[model samples]
Target: MVTLRLIAMAALSFLAASGAHATEVKCKGNEAMLTRYLGMFDEVFNGRKLDRIAEYTSEDFQPHDSAPGTPKGHEAIRLLVTNMAKSFPKRKLTNDLIICGGDMVVAYQTVEGINDGPLFGGIPATGKSFNFNWIDICRFKYGKVVERWGAGDALGMMTQMGFKLTPPSAEAK
Candidate 1:
C-alpha cells in the first residue's frame, strides 16, 4: 500500500511539472516570434528588402508614429521604408532591447545614418550622420504583427540635422 501511494504521488507531480513546462515553452515561443519580428526591421531597413516587411507584418498592420500625416498600412510602410533608404543611403537601425510576453512586444532601437538624399520630411541632405532612439510597441495576433505604436525623438533628429527652431520670445526669457 505504501509503495502504491508513493507511485501515485510521483505521477501527479510529474504531470504538474509537465504542465508548467508546456506553459513555459509556449511563452518562450511567443517571445522568440517577437524578437525575430523586431530583428527583421534591421534586416529590411538596411537591406532595402521591402518584401520582408510583408513576411513579418499582417496584411492590415497599422503603424503609428510621432509624425503628423505619416503613412500607414503595408503599402504605406513599404513607401516609408523606401523613402528612408533614399534619405539615408547609408542607414542602419540597431536594436538595443526587446521585451515580449504573450502577444505583445516592445523594442527599443537607435537609428544611425546620413540623410544624403531627399526624403519625405523634406529635410535636405545635410550629409551628416545622426543617431536617434525610438521605442516601438507591437501587438501580435494569429502569429502576425497586427499593429504598432511608435514614438521617437523627431525634434531631436531635426535639431541634430542643424534645423533650428527659434523659441517663442516669451519663453526665451
Candidate 2:
C-alpha cells in the first residue's frame, strides 16, 4: 500500500509539471476583448477582406482622423481600402504591438508596400517601395469597434517614394 501511494504521487507530480508548460494563462478580459480587437486588424485590414469589416466594427464606425466629408460607417473603410489597393497593390499592415485598457485599445502598426500605381489624386507612380509606421487607438462597444483615431507617417512614405520637399518663398509667406 505504501509503495502504490508513492507511485501515484510521483505520477501526479509529473503530469502537473508538464501541464504547466503547455498551458498559457490569460485573464478573462484579455481572452474576449483582446481577441476581438486583434481580429479587426488580422481579418479586416491585414487580411484585405473588406467584407469582414462589418463583423469587427459597428454600423456607425467613426474615423476621427479621416478627411473632411469622408463617408460614415463601413463605407468609409471600404473607400479607403479601395484607394489604397489602387496605389499599393501589395500593401500590408502589420501589428507590432497592442495594448488594451478598459474599452480602448492601441495598436502600433507598420505599413509596407510597393507603389506600383498613382496616389494623391493621380501623382505618377514612382514604382518605389515604402515602409512606415502608424498608430491606431480604437474604442470598442459590445465587442465591436465604434471609433478609431489613427495617424500614419505619410510624409515619410512620400519621401521614400521620391517626393521632394520645397520651402515656401518669402512672397508666399
Candidate 3:
C-alpha cells in the first residue's frame, strides 16, 4: 500500500506541475471535437457500439498509459474499450471538468463499476465494486484523436477489489 500511495502521489505532483502549459495557440473549434470524444466514450462504454470507435481516432493513434503488450495502432484502442466493457460491464464515467486548448483536450472524470470479469492481463474476476477517478489528455488532429494519456487510480481500484500492496522486502522482487 505504501508503494502504491507513493506512485500515485508522484504522478499527481507531476500532473500539477506540467499541466495546461503545452500550448499558447487558440483552439476555436476543438470544443466540438471534445464533445464528440465524450460521446464516443458513452457509445463505446454504454451503448455498446464498439464498431464505431474508429471514427474518433487517427490512423496512427498513440496510447501513453496503456498496459504492456496492449497492441498498437487504432485497433489497440478498440481493444481497450472492449476489455473495459468485459471487466466492468456496469461502468459509468462522469466527466467533472473539460478544457480544450488548441488541439488538446483534458478531462477529469470518475469511473464507478463492478469488476465481475477478466482484467489486468488475466486477473480473475473479483465481483467487487469500485469507484476511482482518472484524467485523460487527448491530442487531436482533423477531428480524430492522435494521442491520449490516461492517468488512472489503480491503487484505489486494487484496494476496493480486496488486494494488498505488500512491502517489497516482505515479498518477492
Name the best candidate (by TM-score): 2
Q: Where does model 1 exceed 4 Å of error?
A: 1-29, 66-72, 167-173
lDDT of 1 by residue, 53-151 (tens): 877778888777636665666776687677777777876565567777777887776666666887565856787556678887888876667887877
Candidate ordering by TM-score (highest first): 2, 3, 1
Highest-scoring model, lDDT: 2
lDDT for model 1, please: 0.68
Error of 3 at 33 (Å): 2.2
lDDT of 2 at 170: 48
Query: Lowest-scoring 10 consecutive residues by lDDT in candidate 3?
Result: 18-27
User: What tens-digit string does per-residue lDDT give for candidate 2 at 49-163?
Assistant: 8889899889999988899999879998888777887888877676667777778888777676678988878888888766778988888999998998989999998887778
**lDDT (CA) per prediction:** 0.68, 0.77, 0.74
| Candidate 3 deviant stretches above 4 angstroms | 1-29
Query: Clash totals for all models, in order?
Result: 0, 0, 1
Residue 81's lDDT in candidate 1: 75
Better of 1 and 3 by TM-score: 3
Clashing pairs in 3: 1-165
Ranking of candidates on lDDT, top first: 2, 3, 1
